[model samples]
Target: MPLYDYQCSRCGEFRAFRPMRDSQLPQACPECDVLCERTLSAPFLSGASDGCLSRPQGAAPGGSWRKMCGFGCSGAGCH
Candidate 1:
């Protein structure tokens, strides 16, 4: 199962874990009980990587590199 984001017109946004086969199907809003459509949102990729590290050219200073790069870090390459 994968977590998918959904948006309800009356209740705003929420997440649900479901099968990929049912990704296109509408999900019930947990708050309003409305059948909301799936929304296209960025996937959460914390600690996910392809064994490559590419630093941003002009990234702002003073933030978690793991958050900025979406990869786990050991306090290296982060200022």
Candidate 2:
């Protein structure tokens, strides 16, 4: 399985794990149950390369938390 990124019109962006055979199918928004469109995103590269670390979803530029919930929330804390 591979992780794919999708963007919902009402709820924003989210990630889905699906089989390669079904990769072209739209994903249902976990929040609003709407069908989300897939986003063209950069491929994730693991390990330190050129002395730089890979940033995760909620990581801020200054090494502080960006307060993202990784679930298309407004960062005020998702329910």
Candidate 3:
């Protein structure tokens, strides 16, 4: 089952866990009992599945060691 994200118009932030089969159904707001529309959340990528961003490989600045140029957490905020 895929967990989906939903925002309550009455409340604030909330998430609804629904299977892909029932993804199209309307849901009742847990706060005001009104029908709240489901919003699409950003896709979560992890590890190697993150495509090109998986590694922060880039060129090194002039005067820097070549070893420091390869894949590393130089300034891409890997940490």
The parts of candidate 2 lying over 4 Å away from their true place are 46-79
Task: Give the CA lDDT, 0 to 100, for residue 29 in model 3.
Answer: 57
Give all candidates' CA lDDT scores.
0.59, 0.55, 0.45
Question: Candidate 3 has what TM-score?
Answer: 0.46
lDDT tens readout by residue for model 3, 1-79: 4545455555544445568888877666544566666776675333332122212234322212213322332444233
All candidates in order of TM-score, best leading: 2, 1, 3
User: lDDT rank, highest first?
Assistant: 1, 2, 3
Find the candidate with the highest lDDT and give its number. 1
Which candidate has the highest TM-score of all?
Answer: 2
Error of 3 at 34 (Å): 1.8
Model 1 residue 64 CA deviation in Å: 22
User: Residue 53, candidate 1: how far off, in angstroms?
Assistant: 30
Q: Give the lDDT of residue 58 in candidate 3.
A: 47
lDDT tens string, model 2, 7-69?
A: 777656666677989888999976678897778877644332231111244444322112344
**Judged by lDDT relative to the true structure, which candidate is superior, 1 or 3?**
1
Candidate 2's C-alpha lDDT?
Answer: 0.55
Distance from true location, Cα of 60 in model 1, Å: 32
